[model samples]
Target: MATSTLSRWFHGNVGMVTSVIAAIAIIAIFQIINPFFLSPQGRVTLVYAMSYFLIVACGLTFVIMIGSFDFSVVSMLKLGAIICALYIDDLGLMVIPLALLACTAMGFINGLLFAKFKVPSFLATLGMSMVIEGIALYLSRGFLHIISNRAFRSIAVTFIAGLPSIFYWALAIWGVCIFIALATPFGRQIYAIGGNPTAASLCGINVVKKRIYVFMLSGFLSGLAGILYMAQFGGGSIEMGADMSIPLFASVIAGGTSLAGGTGGPQRTILGVILITWTQAGMSMNAIGHDIQLVVFALIAIGMSILTANRKTMSIVK
Candidate 1:
């Protein structure tokens, strides 16, 4: 009986246990390689670097948890930043709301294409990403749009107790997501749909509606990340978010969220974001090449997949 109980406990908590262990091992290795890797300044820099990505990761977590992929997140980020920059001069603070609405609409369209038209999520998001990228490029004429608003800039740069203001923004967003994912009925429904859509639908869950909501939330958060990115960089560029999907996906998966879905949440994503961000920061500190960093990220994704694979549960691995 004791052995059986132990087995059940380990099975229930294996994801969290493994993720925490991996994070600690990586940190220890980095710290050994570079003594300054854990310095106060290094930690602060790591947090700042991860702030925007965390926001994006939080949203992506939901989409992934639904057993769907969203490749348009980078495009949404770029589009949101572009939209905000284009109108900030005329609309002032109103640009923030306008940009978010535009992003949400883009997400809604993705949902419509996937849920209503029966287009595959992967293809729908990929096509939408291309279209959005084209729109951003056309609007900017393939040039950077620099933002000069002090108020907007301060949102990213301002420090509170020695931490970037954007960190707080990310934390708040992450906190809300955790609440929604764990405490709300909507959250439970998401897991149910992801676990078995047929079963969920038969049980009276609105699979289509929830899937749409997931994409919309993903878009909204991606837009939020874009706005923050513009604030931090003081500009918007067509290529700003081109390569974000890799790290964002890595963070979600590394944090213990199963690629197969039906398990994991914002809490797991938080740890994953920290691990990936720390890895990136460590590489920078150690003067590792960008190409090598990309390789490391790829490995991290592959490692997480191997670690989390459950042949019994993963019916269709994407």
Candidate 2:
């Protein structure tokens, strides 16, 4: 009885437990290597640097939890930034909403292609990525478009309690997501659909509609992240979102959200984001090259995937 009870508890809480331990371990190691790793400035920089990615991961967490993938997250981010830059002069503060609306539209199209046309989520998102990238390149003309709007730039630079304003944005978004995921019927339905779509449909869940909403949310967050990125950097470029897949996916997976779905939430992704951010910060402080950092991220992702692989749900991943 004791063994059985212990086993059940461990299995139920493995993701959270492991992530917590891993995060603590990483922080400890890094702090040892550089005594300043936990200093006030360093902590603020780490959170500020990770704010946008954290926001994106929060949105992606929903999509992943529903047993689907959104490959266009990075592209959507780039598109949003480009759109914001293109119209910032004319729209001023309104540019943010307009850009987000565009991204939401793009996500809706992705969902429509998947849920209505029977296209696989992977392929639908992949194709959308290409479309977004093409649009971004054309609009930017293969050059960086500087953001001249002071009000828009202030969004990224404004600090509250010594942390970037974007950090608060990330926190607020995550809070809402957590509430939705834990306290609402919609959240439960997402897990049900992910765990078994046919069964969820039989139980009267609107699988298709929910899936579309998931993608729309993902797109909205991606767009928000893009705007934040532009504000932080003072410009938008076609390459702004290049090669973001690894870190974003890694953060989700490492945080305990399985690609197989139905197993994680926004809270887990928060831990994952912090871990990845800390690792990257440590590497940068240690003078590690960007290429080597990518390798580190890839390896961490692979290891986490292997650790979290749910053999029983392997068939459901498709």
Candidate 3:
């Protein structure tokens, strides 16, 4: 009877349990392989790596939870970073709004294309990414832009307690996402829509509006990530966030937020973020090359997708 109860609990909380196990195992393996992994400096490096990533992944969690995709998340982040780098000297604090507004607009377009025109979410966001990428490249002239603004840099780099300010920002945002997902009426609507769009619409949930708003929320968070990233690094370029797409997707899925929708939330993403970032950190400490890391990330993304994307409703979302 005890065995049966444990099995039932495991099945019911599979995502949570799996994510916890994977996160713990990753920490253990990395700590052993690179004794520096738990060292003070190594811990700082790990936090920085995951902080910006967690900010962006929070947005992806919302979209994925609703059985949708947003490939433009990374591109918009890049664009936001580039915008800040290019205009920080001129706009100072105001450039933030400009960057955020641009990202939000792009996200709105994504929503319109997918919900209004019936474009596949993946295809719609992919196409939007192309356009955003072009704009970013043109703005930066395919060159890296340095940001020398000490005030701007302080936004993310200033140490607070034992960690950087960006770490706190990421943590704060994660908490907000959790609250939004688990508490608000809007949150319930998100799960309802993801679980059954037709029923949600019939039940007065305003599926199209909710979708557009969700995409907009995604855009907003992605932009916030970009701004924070630019501040933390003191520079930006078109390539800044280019390779992040797969990792962020994997992080969200591995966190057990089902791509099938309505099964997970940001609460799980923190563990997945820790797991993936530490793996990368461990690999880097061992002198792993970029090529190897990309390959590994791709495999992880595929594996996680298989585990989380289990419902036919996922296919119908487009």
Candidate 4:
């Protein structure tokens, strides 16, 4: 019976462990290919790349927990950056709060439509995302906004105790989100809604409220990620976060989070983002082109999705 129990535990959690191992392997490979990948400067740079990815993944994890997919996260990220850059000269830190608030409002709108109007989450998010992107372009007039503030700029580029500030932000965000997921009443409600909305509602969970909160969390995180992007780059563009959509989603799934919702945590997603960032940075430093790197990541995401699907089928059969 002990052996049987051990086997069952392994079967259930092997994927999570394997993904961590795979991430470590990728880091090792990067270290081997570019000795700089292990050097202090290189390590900090890698973490810098991982920061925004981690932030976006955190928000996506919550949204996915409610069994809803959000494609507008990238657009929200871009919008936040645009807003921060456009207003920072006049507003300084105030821009940060305003950008986060805007993203939250956008999420609230999406959630309201999804829950009240019965619009499919995917379609609603997609349409909202386009609208956001459009607004970003209009504000920028198809140009980049150059950010000149030294203090805010340091938020991404400065090193704190041998780590990038963005890295610290990523860690803080993950830590806080994990705490909420594990300890908060809202977090419990989100999981319940994700696991089974109908049953959760029957059990007195306010499914609509939970969904709104989840999306709001997603929006806020995306906004913060955009701000980080601007700080890191010293400027922003409507295109700043356009390429992050697939990679952010891929990181969540690769980290063993269920897209069907109610499973996984920010910690797992962080591991996944770190792995992908390491892989991308290592290749780039070694002179590998962006096209090849993206293709490889796409393939990895596909494999993980297949694995997740097969595992679900096996569970049902059992």
TM per candidate comes to 0.95, 0.96, 0.96, 0.94
Which runs of model 3 end up more than 4 angstroms from their true locations? 1-6
lDDT of 1 by residue, 1-318 (tens): 999999988786676677788889989999999988778787788887899999999999998898888999989999889988888899997899988998999999999888888888889999999999888899888887999999988999898998889999999999999999999999999999878888999999998899999999999999999999999889967878655678888899888788777888898898889888888888888889888888888888888877766667676433
Instruction: Please state the error at residue 45 of candidate 4 in Å.
Output: 1.2
Q: How close to the true structure is residue 252 of candidate 1, measured as C-alpha lDDT?
A: 91
Clashing residue pairs, backbone N/CA/C < 3 A, model 2: none
RMSD of each: 1.6, 1.5, 1.5, 2.8
The CA lDDT of each predicted structure is 0.88, 0.88, 0.88, 0.82
* Model 4 worst lDDT window (10 residues): 309-318
Task: Residues 1-318, candidate 2: write the lDDT tens digits.
Answer: 999999998886677668789889999999999988889988887887689999999999999998889999999999999998888998888989999999999999988998888888889999999999998898889887998788898898898888788888888989999998989999999999888888999999999999999999999999999999998889867988666899899899889888778888997899989888888888898898989989888987887877777878766334
Model 1 pairs in collision: none
Model 1 segments more than 4 A misplaced: 1-3, 313-318
Instruction: List candidate 4 segments past 4 Å from native.
Output: 310-318
lDDT of 4 by residue, 201-241 (tens): 99998887888888888999999999998999888777676
Clash pairs, candidate 4, are: none
Q: How accurate is candidate 4 locally (lDDT)?
A: 0.82
